[model samples]
Target: MFEAVLVANRGEIAVRIIRTLRALGVRSVLAASVPDRRSLAARLADEVVLLEGRTAADTYLDVEAVVAAAKATGCEAVHPGYGLLSERPDFAAACAGAGLTFVGPSPETLTLLGDKVAARDLAIANDVPVAPGAEGTTDAELAEAARDIGFPLMLKARGGGGGLGMRVVANPEDLAAAIEAARRQTAAAFGDDRLFVERYVENAHHVEVQVLADAHGNAVHLGERDCSVQRRHQKLVEETPSPVVDPSLRDQLTSAALRLMRAAGYENAGTVEFLVGEPEEGRRPFYFLEVNPRLQVEHPVTEAVTRLDLVALQLAVAAGQPLPFAQDDVRFEGHAIEFRLNAEDPWRDFLPAAGRLTALAAPGARLDTGYEAGDAVPSEYDSLVAKLVVHGPRRRETLPRAAGLLEAASLDGLRTNLPLHRAVVADPAFAAGEATVQWLERDLPALLD
Candidate 1:
């Protein structure tokens, strides 16, 4: 095990990692921006390195500064909790070049899976199904390719994640404008303007399989998560043992996910997302979406069900340890749900709400957060302030518990989607596990009113 490590991200994830590091008897060095110097993670870590910036560009996303901080602190490895530079292949390679272990997959694997078009091709080569799509580098090329993909297709940024740089074009008349807008957004978000088009599955369920792999080629799947409850293609809620998947479908999803991991020589914690659609006249049940080559935001749900500490596992893997268990050794019990508590007002088009947290409370759930009642939520960063994870013996039992937790929450000084979450858990469609990707957008208005 590593004696010391640096957490290369901020907010709740950094706090989450630092807690795990303490449990594992590893010293944690937190890298914090100027604004985050007094944050919860910074206070909790054994040592704090103040990166020289207030914005993400010169702070968390600065690979050179992060590596330098780790080296200066004598950290043997770096754990990128998630988001920002977590999925960047160059960042991984920089760590390698700096003689520090990155607690994720190899740079080659990151590069291969980070590109959506390449990942789709990889899925196809492995016999995993993918939606029909074509990659194009220019506006004219993309526009030309859309003619063949047909109407109601999705315009996506090849290098984008977190639901940015994506648009749904219902007709040819809007293709050019959508393409330009997606390109600009993609460039601003990911520094890549490449785009692709794919046929959209309107009512598909977004399911993802979690896999843990070691450097020695041993890997195991930790079942699946139902992330269909989304807004703007970004997941809002996630749960394990999807209510819609049966034994057979679960096996298929897990097997396909494992196959992709093995083929890519993947290591550490990663997620394979898929779009699962009801069988149409001739279509298959599921199509490969993309690979998230890092610890996911919703990893707590998987940990609750599998009874495993993923951060510890990632640390072990990076330390050259083989997986302690195999596929059959893994046992999943009960159902777990995670609700992302973001500082946003759902009734007002989900506008970001940033302010001092005057009063805060999270009851009836396990809370993971980086802020307290006195912390300030800056407008510069992601709106997510905390996560509430609930576990129960079965899926049916989780809904009411989740609802109670949301209702009992007493956040103040900033508007939140607590009411929205409360509404979702009580909604019959969601309670019945029939919520699709479009359910929030299509049905939330009626529930709110």
Candidate 2:
């Protein structure tokens, strides 16, 4: 075990990492921006190194500052708790150069899986099914590719995934504008302007397999998660043992995920996301989406079902330790659901809000959050303020408890999407596990009205 580790992120993830470090007896040194000096993560950390800048660009996203803090704090490793610089190859390389272990995949793997286009090609080479797609460095190339892929194709940035630089083009007339917009967004968000076009499945489920590997070549798939309940391509609710996926489909998803992970020589915790279509002829068609090469925001739900500490696993792998368990040893005990509570107003088109959280009341269930009462919800970063995770013996038994928890929970001083989450859990389609990626957007008007 490491004597000390630097937590190089913020919000609920930062706090989550700190808890694991405490349990493992690893001293935690937090790298916080000026605005986060008084954050709950800072209070929980054994030590704090304040990054001078207030904005993400100069602080959390700055590779040099984070590395320097880890070195200065005498940390033996760094754990980037999702987002920010978590998937940045340069950041991982910098940590290696500084003789500090990065508690994630190697830089080489990050470089390979971080680019959407490259990952798609790798999947094809590994014989893993992927949506028909073509890559382009310019609008002309993408425009030509779109003509073959046809209308209703998705335009996505080659670098970074999280629905940031993505657009759905309904027809040729909208291609150029969508291309320009996607390019600009991708360039600003990921420092890459390259784009790709692929066939868009009108009705699909967003299912992802959680896989963990070690440097010693041992790997296993934890299971699949259904993140179909979404809005604007962003996931709002995630659950394990996707209510719609049967045993056969689950085997295919996990097998494909393990094959890709082994082929890429991936290590540590990573997620393989896919777009799954409805069943036809007794089989569901699933296509590769993208790989997230770091810990994900929805990890807690997986933990609830598997009874595993992913953060501990990441640390063990970074220390060059072999996986303590094998494929057969892993078990999925129950169904778990996680609802992302963002500081946004559902009535106003889900506009992000910021203010002091004057009141907060979560009576039961697991609530992972960085802000407490009297804490300010800043507008400069991600809108997510907390995650409410509920677990039950089965999906049917889980929905009511999750709904009740949301009902009892309260947050004041800023608008929240709580009402929207309430509506989702109570909706028949969602409760029946029939919600797709487009369900929320398609039915939002009726649910809200």
Candidate 3:
């Protein structure tokens, strides 16, 4: 394990990392914006370095400031909890150049997987299947490049995630406008306007495999996550052992993820996403989506089912330790689901809600949160306040348990998506396995009314 480590982001994830660092006998250093200096993560760290900015863009996302804090604190490693700069290849490289472990994959690996277009090429090279879409970048050349990959394509930012900078153009006439909008949004969000084109998949169920690679070149997938409950590509709920994936499809997901990780020489934990279409007869087909190179917000659900401490593994792997067990040693039991408790209102178009968390508690489940009752949720970052993870012996048991957990939720001082979650958990369609990307928007209006 590292002697000392600096966490590169803020909020609950920072606290989560800090607890692990302390348990491993590592000194923890926290970087924070001025106002966040009084937050829980800062209080938990052995040392807190306050950046002279108020917003995440000027502080947590500032690579220079983060590295400077590490250098100042004599920290030997940096862990990007999640979000913000976790997936940035440049941040990883910067840490390496500064002689500190990045505690994640190599910058090369990040770049290869972060770009949607390049990742597709890698999947193909490793014999992994992807959606049938345009093989090249430059959505601006849509008209000239129509022969190979035709219409009903998706304009996607190569570096995009979190449901930003993506547009589906169903017709040729809307292609140019979609490309421009995607490019503009991509430039605004990630500062990378590079975009790609892929065939638009209809009514596809989103599935992902969580794979862990060690420095010793051993890679194995933990299991699969069914993230089909989404809104505009943003996952709202996630669970393991997908209802649609059978044993054969499970093998396909595991094998493909391992193959790609081996091909890229990847290390640490990562997620390989796939677009699974509704089953046709007895055959089911899946298309590859982009990979997330760091820990996911919904990792708790995986941990609940796998009985693995992913953080411990991450630290050990980054320190050059071999995995303690092989693929056979891993076991999966029960089902786990995660509900992201975001400070957003379901009424009036899911608008962001920011205020003091006067009273906060989630019932009937394991609550992983970065804030407390007294904290003020800022508008500068993601609205997620906590992750409520529930587990049971099977999906049937898990479903109602999730509903019970939401009923117990109480974020007294602030508005949250708890009501929306309650609606989802109680809906007959959701309970009967009819939840989809469009279900929320379609049903929310009437439910809210």
Clashing pairs in 3: 12-370, 133-199
lDDT value for model 1 = 0.92
> Where does candidate 2 stray beyond 4 Å?
none
* Model 1 ranges off by over 4 Å: 281-284
Better of 1 and 3 by TM-score: 1
Better of 1 and 2 by lDDT: 2
Q: Hey, what RMSD does candidate 3 come out at?
A: 1.6
The model with the greater TM-score, 1 or 2, is 2
lDDT per residue for candidate 2 within 248-283, as digits (tens), equals 899989999999999889999999999999887988
Candidates' lDDT values, in order? 0.92, 0.92, 0.84
Error of 2 at 341 (Å): 0.5
* Model 2 clashing residue pairs (backbone): none
Please write out the lDDT profile of model 3 over residues 66-167, one tens digit for every residue.
999999999999999788889999999999999999989999999888878888899998899887766345654655554357777777777868878778
Which is the leading candidate under lDDT? Answer: 2
TM-score of candidate 1 to 2 decimals: 0.97
Put down candidate 1 lDDT per residue, 1-449, tens digits, no spaces. Answer: 99999999999999999999999999999999998999999999999999998899989999999999999999999999999889988899999999999999999999999888988988999999888889887788888888888889998888869888889999999999998898889888888989999998878899999999998989999999999999998889999989888888898999999999899899999999999997667443998989999999999999999999999999999999999999999999999999998999998999999999997788768898999999999888999989899999998888788888888888888999877888889899998888999899999889788
Off by over 4 Å in 3: 135-140, 144-151
